[model samples]
Target: MAKLTTRGLRIDSGGTGGGPVTIAAEDVAGALGMGRLKPQAVLVGRATFCDDNRAQLELAKWVQQELHRRCRRNGWKTDYCEGLAQLCVFELVHPLRCVHCLGRGQLWLQVPERRGERIVLVERWRTCPRCKGSGRKRLTVRDRAAVAQIGKSQFADVWAERADAMLSDLYGLQDDVLRHLWKQFADEAA
Candidate 1:
């Protein structure tokens, strides 16, 4: 298997055959390699992006495991830890985008309109009820506390700070991975 690494971008030929093959810059060398592919940069960029996304997901799982460990050490129940950890992972991976309007802050509703001799359905835009025009999901303090498996006051005082730090680290990792992928592509293009 070919292994390639540039900065933090790694592409190893060790995935299932059905999945995308992450080809690195080194793998593009020689006649029988990816050099034969026209617009090699675009294909390589896509593969690199996919690999980075997979890496981010793995990092999110690590964050969940760390959160679960903290919960156990803090005497939280084991049964709740798994679900709460998963929730934290979801929040870490997905941005605070509204699911209802898909972050558009508006929805198109079909309403009945009377037009002379017939009733017609007209599409009208309305502010999203879930996000209330904010275009972002409302993750309340109560909900955060629930995920932390602690009282609201305790969560605000202690767990909130810790969780925020963890989330920041995860975001930083994602940013770094993207930067690395971009750098790799730039190097390849040169």
Candidate 2:
């Protein structure tokens, strides 16, 4: 599926076989039933200046009007419009997990079975019936040296750095529009 981050609204559609293509906000918004939301709304802040919310709304309204205009021009399937609108809302809603990992970072790891021939699998230790001596489980580690290597989240600072990097992208143009419009508007206006 094509996952488009349109103004922080992720709209997934029938992708082009390859990966999803990221297009301009207008294109994605239009595809996802944002015909009522204007590309102008997206571009206006980025391109021009409007201090008040009403100006931005006007721009968005203009964009929606344009989307509808294009629908008529292109003879698009307006029937799918509702579904696309739902996609718009879905995009705005906070995603539970990262689309990349689907929440879990590491893929399922298959533990290697111990065998008689392997040098590491000497008689001293047989298959770790629990982890199969793979040391896969964080708590279970037959290797004393390896066990010491595991590091905890030690400090909130370390965790904070990871939090900053690991979490889904927290902010975007549209996000600012919704939250910090004055700053964004000024930034864009400047």
Candidate 3:
């Protein structure tokens, strides 16, 4: 048997190379000073990057649920769930278009043209102020409010800010996962 100490309490791990040991949820709850811990779902199978991503999403979903439950005691707790949902959905469904340029990638500016004895306004093209040269930008509070429900519209500003940071992290995680998957596939092919 192997002994492990946690907070001055020693735990026995049966023996070395004992495969995997399963602990009761009640035991974990007792350790954490909780009344009880009941698992809602358990997913067991071959793990892959895709599975890892799914598990992470599931965890996020659970966190949102817990936040909502806690909102009964404190109203501010609900914002966390709303913010997380908005951030996740912003990338999945809401594609951004520069409001200033109207997705044209450029702005039409009116310039004064001197022609002989008369001055006339002529339309000139300039890069979009909102999105620079790219027609697309990240979803903004206004953009979200345009299509969001009355309830969702209230948290648009807050969600947009958090969504920006979350989106960048999500993109990086996706890129890493794709690279890993590609390398694994290439290795198997060779």
Candidates in order have lDDT scores of 0.53, 0.33, 0.44
Per-prediction CA RMSD (Å) = 13.7, 20.8, 19.4
User: Candidate 2: which stretches are off by over 4 Å?
Assistant: 1-67, 99-190
- Across 1-190, the per-residue lDDT of candidate 3 in tens digits comes to 1111243222222232223233332332233322221221221000112133555455456535654665555555354565454444444333466777876678889989999999999999988877785566665555554433324565554444544554454444433432333333334444
Q: Order the candidate numbers by lDDT, best to worst.
A: 1, 3, 2
The stretch of ten residues in a row with the least summed lDDT in candidate 2 is 139-148
Candidate 2 clashing pairs, residues 3+ apart or interchain = 35-64, 36-64, 38-63
Best by lDDT: 1
Which structure is stronger by TM-score: 1 or 3?
Answer: 1
**Which wins on TM-score, candidate 2 or candidate 3?**
3
**Over the stretch 1-190, how does candidate 2's per-residue lDDT look in tens digits?**
1132434323222231222223455433233222232343444433222223554445444444444564577675343333222222222232334333343333344546566765342333233444333223321122211222222332232322322221112223344333233322224334
Give the per-residue lDDT digits (tens) of candidate 1, residues 12-125.
222322222344444333211223233322223333343446544454455567777877787854444443454455565444879899877789999889999999999999
Ranking by TM-score: 1, 3, 2
* Collision count of model 1: 0
The TM-score values for the models, in the order shown, are 0.42, 0.24, 0.35
